[model samples]
Target chain A: MSEGFGLRSLHPSVLLLYYAGGITFGMLLFHPVLLLSGWAACLIVNGHLDGGREWRSWSLPMLGAFVALILVNPLISHRGRTVLYYMGDIPITLESVVYGATMASSLLGLLTLFVSYRILMTEHKFLFLFARFSPKAALLAMMAAGMVPRLRRRLKELMLVQKTRGIAVSEGTVTQRARNGARLVGALLSWSLEDALQTADSMQARGYGTGTRSSYPAFRFGPRDAWTAGGLFAAAGIAFTLWANGHGYLTIYPRLESFSLSKGDVGALAAYLVFLLMPLGWEWRDRTTWRSLNFGK
Target chain B: MNLLRRKINPKLLVIPIAIIYLVLAYVSLTRGNALLIGIVLVLLSMIPFVWRFERRQRQARELVLIAVMAAVATVSRIPFAALLPNFTPVTFIVILSGVVFGAEAGWMVGAVTGLVSNFFLGQGPWTPWQMFAWGMAGFTAGLFAHRNPSRRRRLPLLLFGAAWGYLYGWILNVTVALDVGVREQTWSSVLAVYSLGLPFETVHAAANVFFLVVFAPSWIKLLERYRRKYGALQRTDSGSADMEGSAHGQRTAAE
Candidate 1:
């Protein structure tokens, strides 16, 4: 799974399925808890699916950011009825704390999912998905996405060189730090100008932004893709229906509301569960098929 | 270094810069006021200055250096300012551009930094103001590229930079206040808002002084070294020597 599901190797259809599922889930659910839970599930699954090495590197920072969000958000936005305490003209409240936690969770979930997608989805997949719409735009998007990691690497190299030269920026006075930063910026600008020209030249040589364009063929809507997409659509439909009928949980500010579930809501939720489980099923089947092929070998 | 020495045709930079300017103009004209359009036009005008440098050298190395600087300048401003002191590294960045690549490069750095930084800050009518303020700061810095080095003379340049820093913030505040429909067009109202931004302005000015004091000598040394090692400084022809001598004499007196 680690090798096959790597971002560079993932099929475009698979990426599309993930995006469609996320958007549908986001739109269908309004309850803060459920929305947050959905977001967490996406993040954890995304992180785990990418494998342990990547997860290990990101987990600490992710946790730190989450804690920071929880601690900081409530302090700044102290607005609620249930006052927990008062500190120097500022009033803290239970509602505000909960709201802050929920917001943090939501953001964390989004970040997790985004990071997972970034690590799992490759430029090839992105280009493949959008190839038919606008080839030049798609190519540009691919280039932009690819540029992030490359730019990061370049900056790291520059920082190291600066450090070696005894121009330690982080340890300096505010003014000295600013000067050091300026020197780095000067170097970086000179670097990027050259890159942009090369990129433009390379792109132009290939007839980018021309009237017509060609693409490499890799994406195909197979049975697995069909099954995944169909399940997502069905789940989306049921979720939308539940949302429209006001059957699912709803919460307004300062008031918690949970509508009594009907037989229809139960059915819709059951369908959602099945839709969510479809990917797990695909993973199982693929594993089983591999085992079968290797039997007695 | 090789890239900095290579010659780039000025004409090539013209089309790309013009296209960007026209697009900015169109956006402002359609969605904003004349003030916004005027700001954008001023910012866009900096492109020609950048092109002037490119006309002499089309080296990939120089191009990369400029682009990376622009990106760093853009990224450095991303984090929320409530926690940090201020976002003033950009002024220093502009100065560095002038020191390393000359005036044209400095102007380009400012313009690109403004435009790119706006992407994360939320793009709208205010982008042009940010662009012009930073671009002007860089252009002003570049104007002093040939100034001789003396502590007394440097003091005024530093003060000039500091003043430019505050002036930029004041202009930005006015433009933004107008855009948001605050409608307090009086001097008092403008002062009230601009005064609030004093901390940020002070930080910017201080940053400029800091950057200039620390890096100016090093930059001058680097340029001298480059001229010595690679023989990059153009030899003054006999006819031009007299003109250069007078200019040199004036610079010496100024120092």
Candidate 2:
């Protein structure tokens, strides 16, 4: 869906493994370099996904969240010994601020990665992931995913109709407004419930849950998927090795430790970055090659 | 006290686990490792309890109903956000779902709403916590609602909704703060986070109270009617006999 990582084109199985591994790494690792690399990778993928339009909108909010964390963390946490000045009786320790910054970066990193996931993991992908495990739950998730957007659209229409009738949400006092909102919801509830009953009937008619349900397979494993998966595992293995060995590790508890890079640190960081950027790398290669072939004399 | 009942009230273990975790979280606020572990434990502790419901309700209709409730809860936030800005109808709908559908359905609705809505809000580390917080809200509300189904009163439901507002906020605050890291163990730091969140909590609680006060009766009646007419599964034996009467009751209400 993006110029960066058309991750959706990859087989859902590959995408799933990539995301599960990526998110796990993003969540577990707290190294500043790794976090920053992950965050930057997410932003770039997200930027490409939206064709460079919506990523800016997210940047400001993400920055705001990070800034808010920076301000709040030091105030609540006072563990570090280095006093960086005090606001009233509170000692805003250097370590806590640094820790907060790390957290903010990690948070930002995790959030952006999820944004990429939103782009990469469509409802079909989500359903595909769950379908093998529990067909009923998969069906439910699919219906629920479809229903959210449909219901939201319906609510907007209802609100518009209500507004035309002078019983709109904004036109009343606090209680009146809430009543108006609830009434709208109540109406939707009855309608949707009736609609759902029909669905249940239709599903029963189609013999749902009668036996092992067969799903329409929209994906197949191919050589490209296998190669990409291999690369992902190899990179991830190397990175995990470095991480487990304490390379590129920076501790912020008790006292702030040094973040100086050694040779092994650089290797670990590179391995980690490679693991994170595998999808982006594929997409970039594809785009550049396609562009050159088309424009070449 | 027999530790295990045939019909396990998950709240028995879940509630105590949460309280113990919260206490641990409070005590270890300054220690990053303990705080992190406490937060993860708090999020995970509710799973075994909620898992019981998932296994209990394996029927397609029940599954569809819970999904529908979750979808409705997710979408209901839009109008409220548009109109009230700070207020959300999500918790109200979630609580109502629990009250009408009983604990399992309520728990499912709550957890699913958190996940489905995060598709719009953008998922983060906070998602599991949201799922846990909302799931518990539905669990307890359903518990209360199940205990006294015949009396669908206003005050108690309203009070429960209001209480959940603050409780949800506190849980959410702790989750986010822990995610963000609260480096000191001091009560003041924890209090500061709570105080900063006071206005939002008040708004959330007020919104819950307001929604329940206004629409809970009608929604409950509507869902009850549907359950009766469609022969939706029930979680309690006490209400089993009332089904036939309510089926006709739904027909008349529709008419």
Candidate 3:
């Protein structure tokens, strides 16, 4: 119902910085332990951020997915040295289970980060930040993103219309449901064709793909953004340098090895924490402002 | 402008265009050597259909129709592998585009459907084949843009829809074979791979036929109702005049 985050409020610079940081984090610090920790932190933060009903609804599904991943993944990937038991041809292994958990946690972490980012950024800001480099592509991307909610609304309306016409979509058997689905698809396509034509006309009229465009600069790099970017770059550079100079890359195959955390690793992790905290700082600032408003009481 | 002169309707182009696409797709599948050439021809053919359609109609309305159809088709494909095993809703969506928006709308819908759907599915050389196949199906459906009940002749239309599904699968197989550099590109190899896809193809055909039967009548009725209510259906000459006036208004406002 809330339709997630409003991208309009955040500075484009912050969004870019955050996005860049996420990519770097994914590529560089992709260890099982670090990934799990980050994922746990993200879930805790997101759960707090998403207020009551939404979190309540999501919790069960999240737990189900987590359990399914942990249980099923180990059964398929039984290639570790530490074999726990053998169920016929299938060899259960402690290493494989741990490795699976790591992979699942990493996926969950990445998903959480993406969901948070989606909530925080608006399409206009997203386009504005990226458009200077590629206006046509960026505009298309923005339109594509904006179109999702519109289509969802249209689908709901179509569903209601179908229902009123005594098209018992829910009450049907499997074959009947499939038939109903086919009919719904047809109706949706019909409406979509008309909508697409109108949208294209409007876009074309406004000089879309005309090779000329204008911009309004709404995002600027404040001190917080600058510090975050600088910290992330320095951390990434040092990590790359160390890895290039023979620092061990963590391997999750065959067996799990605890890589000794070097000085560089420690520094990189600290910087990563700072990068993560940037959003928290903004939240704190907002909370402080709210508290200050109640000073008279 | 005379308000009663009969003009060559672009809506009639859908049937022949669909036939051409089906032929190309069928030929390409049965013979692998012509795969590249067939794709290029099909894509190139779309330009003329689109150009002619734009010239004759309110381009804005048509463009919107294309965008909406394309977007819906793309969105529908996203949840297919994610949600259902034998899902092929985009095929039905393309058909719906043709039935509702007319022939040109169907063409645009097909083109955009192929292009946009590839983003979620991943893009490759096969993208062009997909675009052409889906686009043709929609375009062809638009050709039979009449409101008569006898037009509801189900069997032939069902067969036509089923053939389009196979045609799409066949072209896609050719693209895959070519990409993988299968040196022989023989009938056996194509048959072996496409045979495996028989279930999917069957589902695709069944879905399209099911959709066509259920919603086609009601959609035609709705279109007729709209035309009668708004007096949008015009005598041929008057239609052109209205189209031109609308186009002129759009051009000025855009400038």
Candidate 4:
């Protein structure tokens, strides 16, 4: 509905395919080197999309999670043979430590990809894609999503008015605060339900359930999308086949293998990165076109 | 879209589901791909609920009732967002939705609460997991409420809420544990994930007990009145959100 650029201009299915493939490949490829490279590519793509502001906003929690995984894995699982140190009779293995770091990198890469995902896959695109597959459930999620802002405003109003009646959640003991919070929500619930049923009557008057619902125009599956989807599938197919043959995962247990990429791993890594960053080409193309049309680059 | 309107024979549905699980079983067993398998299973588990809801001929009031309940569940978190991390009336609201509207409506509310809340926040591996977990919490709440006669009873409802507080947390924690990419997962490694989540789950369980103690009676009464006045989700027990969930639950379990 709004003007979009680069990845946002892609069809919703293609966008969905990109994320699904990105996450799947990120999870499947377990080499720390590959994961680190994946993280770099992910961040660069994130920067290309929105200058990485969204990625920056989510950095703290993701970093905390990253560190937690790095610390927790070595402590809990004692499988790896290369024990780096001992903590109270618990042997900290270098293998588990490396495994944890790789996991953390995969996670960081996932969070970065999701930041781009949130930017490109706007709500309208999500609803449009899901609506075909599961109509009522899609409608349910969409309508509920639509109602959140209005309900939020009403809840704020209720909370403000209820503060005058010596009722507020912010300034109470544990039990007291919980009660006041639910009280505000209860009031909000009653108020919203009243208006909601009226809206339902309007929906009924418009013959909502009378026939199969016609939809608004969805984005066309253009030639650009076709080529992108074709390339994505081809690259991913190569990567997945190699991964299935055991090139993607690192050998962590029963003594760790060297992190050097074999020929198969290199091939898999190449295909995977191509699949991961193919959409970046769209951004370069879009930027050059925009610059030629509007201003000097 | 039209496919959902046509009656989907469960026996017919089983063929595709069985094939999917078979393929997934091969992948997970051979490749040790826990993360992808876990995510796929979570996504598949939600289909029956969505399928059940789609096939039913719903009244506008019922649809609106579910949308409003889900919105309320999503927004109910705002009041306490500053007070604690992961503390909110969302679970209670979802449970109440199940208790008042019946299990199917409760499940829809819970699942939609998961979907809508994450859409408002952001999507991650947890989106489908939250949907399944929250949906189960609400499903069980409705199942218990429906089987039992007394609607406003406190002790049973409080225990139910308390159990799901931890159960909900653990359901979400499973994804994280598997997502950690353990090559060969032993029992202790799984235990470590649970141990990591213990504090948050404890607070969550305590919060559920507190909310149930404080607001069950008044909130249930408030919604009960609306269900009667608007005649929303109050048709014969066969076709509405309430009774359909038990049947659906049995089918999902069987699968």
Candidate 5:
């Protein structure tokens, strides 16, 4: 549970918009420069939050797929004209290479953005956003998420106690291990089903469905949140409008365009960066506030 | 206007909007943007179901029962996180949840299990697809179990589980496979993607069959016993479908 500070402290709706816009623009603008820039922004934001710990942890698989997409696009759809080289009979086109890199960057950008999303959008925050519209699902998901740890702990206890009954799943033939795992699960289910129902009864006793449910720790949409949201939408509007005019996308089909950005593309990129990094304004403010309080001149 | 509002379900108004959006997407976006189309369709298909579940008042026991089922499905993955790659008991539990609980509860359990499990594993583009696939598995199980789910019926469930094993793989793989085929407009490209997943699909199917054969009967009996004990979520018996019954307190399922 990473604490909500800086970007995390923002209202959940604002956080949701940040990610939604980040992903939307990432998909909308297929240019390599724009995609790479968005990914870099995500990395900077990730670093600002947790010193890139979470980002680095997820970087390997994301980068692996990132590289895979870049390499595989040229191989799979051999449609472009500029032949770079030949591997056996397969010709690699410059257009395809560019397309691959564009896709790779887009994938990386989206995945990196989600890394920060998972950090910021914890279960409570997610429920906060959804509770009003779908209270039942939100409550159910909340309860289920809450039970996961207890259930896992119980399963661990089951595995240990049942190990004495010659039901060790860790060390045995594949079949034996699989069978033992099943047995442990069966026992766990019976124990949990009985226990969970009791909790349900306790809940009913306490007037579980008595009144309309209220969201806990009700997040207020403060003036700061409004400003952040406004700035975010304004920037997003510009970026989206620019893209709608075909400014941000790098066309690489049957022919390739220069990697250099046009005037409108640069403006689009600026709007995109502003929208992405708006939360960082709060992060910066918080950092300065902390610094001044701790080590003031 | 009030009469018109009552005539048409305001809840389902998003369908035409989604259709128009999809048509616009099909017209404007490239072939590769089908992932977005798929996600829109998935959410559109799910909205009415979710909206209905939301409006319908449920008992504490019913809600908790679904929660426990989802939680268990998620936690069960922990013990086997590194076990045989395709052999997780999640699908087995989900299917049994449907078979015992009926379609709505089954779908919720499966969907919630997918979502909550991803909270631990990782959330990504694939999460929605997984939720839809697994939820449908539970839903179909409920339907398959029919009115009186018999403990003697192992073959049908085993087959269902096995089929979902492949079906699950197909659901996950289809979007990407179609992307490839749609790009090339060739059957070979799609087949290549499908064939690439053959081993995983086979193992998943086999694992589903294996678990259902060994565990389905007892699990079904256990869940049914609990349902009868709780006297919650029996809103309908097999044939009558009393979903909108006013009596929330009584044992609604006919003995």
Candidate 6:
């Protein structure tokens, strides 16, 4: 179950919609508790996906950038009334610090979500979404995506071949190296141009865009996907309603707004937490099911 | 004459809309919202326009040209990824695409390059914005292509490339600022944001100028030669028909 059922098993539209909603809320909501919860959920989900190894490398740089943002916000932005400190005529305040933290949380949450997205949503998934809109554009995008790594390897080969010929880009003055680089690109252009012509001929022969085309879909929108999408929309609806009503608004401006909790706040928090944890919950359930089935087997 | 019947200059419309969006984004900063709705709106509106621009009857040669150009631009980012940080042949390729294939193709190539390259580099919030910036860069280049035909008039292309370097950096900086939520009405905070990014903008501009001066001529000539030879395969009659239709529309609107 764990191997078979995870975020990747979900329909592409479901996964895309989930990210769309999550990323939207992550960017728009500034409530501290909500943001911190979303950020934590992102970290945990990312940990489960990558076995927490990346956080070790990510911590140092994420911390550095996070701290830089927090410190820089207060120094440059002289907002709010509660002055915390002063340095040579500049005043550092609490509101800016809080604002910086919220901003950092949003930024980090977004980064984490995108990392997980990159792992789960493969190129075909993206192209599937694009192909629904425009088949030709998607084909072009597919070609371009496939061309990059190929060209990188080709460039490396070109570099080695050119190096042996004594016209390498690496071994020269800056201008000479640039000229060498330009030459390599020129050679690649003509080479790929001919290759592309062949491809065009092949595509023509295949009768592309001649009539209605059918695709071999790798995944289907099953009942589970529908249920997941329904749950997502319901959670998003509740969360958006709470947001519109100012249930958990955090204001850090000319004056710092005190963090308080109410009945509506609790509801908003619950809804948001459920929304953020939806994918993780699926993964956990699948993992547990896998453990039980394996033991029985 | 009905006011709605007036033909609008599509080229002139984009700049004013962009300026309005920027102004609204600036205002939103002071209004306590972290969301850059203005920029979001600008980008959202662009999607349908770009889609419509490409949903035309095109020859296989034109389609092949767009695909090849997008592939080249996407691939060109590879070798330079190590040589010059954040500087790639994408802009040069896209600009040359615009110059040779005209504005619609330019926009497609620019936008497609962003979408495809991010598959390798990883996509984020910046992906759509990058697409918009690169698309606009290509569109602007195409806007000037008619006047700057031939490799002889290459200075304007060079200047355009250099200007876009800073412009792309500035727009991306706004994305960062949106994250930071720097909404002070005074110029100091904005100045700080710009100053913090000044070094990067400088490097990007220098790289753009260098690439343009170095490779623009050869690439432009190569693409132009292709366009002249192969592009005319099925476009010879329809291309003129399109120009004549636009002229007729403009003339009727004048009357």
| Candidate order by decreasing TM-score | 4, 5, 6, 2, 3, 1
Give the clash total for candidate 1. Answer: 31
Pick out the ten consecutive residues of candidate 3 chain A with the lowest summed lDDT: A1-10
- What's the CA RMSD of model 2 in angstroms? 7.7
Which scores better on TM-score, 2 or 4? 4
Residue A160 in model 3: lDDT: 81
Q: In model 3, state the lDDT of residue A95.
A: 71
The lDDT ranking, best first, is 4, 5, 2, 6, 3, 1
Alpha-carbon lDDT, every model: 0.53, 0.72, 0.55, 0.80, 0.79, 0.71
In the order shown, the chain A TM-scores of the predictions are 0.71, 0.91, 0.75, 0.97, 0.95, 0.92
Q: Return whichever of 2 and 6 wins on TM-score.
A: 6
On DockQ, the leading prediction is 4
DockQ of each: 0.08, 0.28, 0.11, 0.50, 0.43, 0.28
lDDT of 2 by residue, A1-297 (tens): 442234667777678778766765664566677678778877777776676465565678888999998888887777877999988988889988987787788778877777777777776777776565445555666778779888888888888887877777776687787778778887777778888888888878888667766778776666667778899999878876775565655678788888777676787778767877777766777778878999985
Task: Give the lDDT of residue B43 in candidate 3.
Answer: 54
Maximum-lDDT candidate: 4
lDDT of 5 by residue, B11-98 (tens): 3555675775566356335634443556556766677667767766678888888898999988876666567887888899998888
Point out where model 4 deviates above 4 Å: B1-29, B178-186, B235-255
Give me the displacement of residue A194 in model 2, in angstroms.
2.0
Q: What is the DockQ score of candidate 6, to 2 decimals?
A: 0.28
TM-score of chain B of each: 0.59, 0.74, 0.62, 0.81, 0.83, 0.75
Which residue pairs show collisions in model 2? A77-B183, A77-B184, A78-B184, B30-B185
- lDDT per residue for candidate 5 within A111-220, as digits (tens), equals 89988888888877887776655788988988999989898899999999998888977888877787788888888888888898898999899988899875566566
Higher DockQ: candidate 3 or 4? Answer: 4
What are the runs in model 6 whose C-alpha is more than 4 Å off?
A: A1-3, A53-61, B1-31, B36-39, B150-152, B178-182, B232-255
Choose 3 or 6, whichever is better by TM-score.
6
The stretch of ten residues in a row with the least summed lDDT in candidate 6 chain B is B232-241
Error of 2 at B37 (Å): 4.8
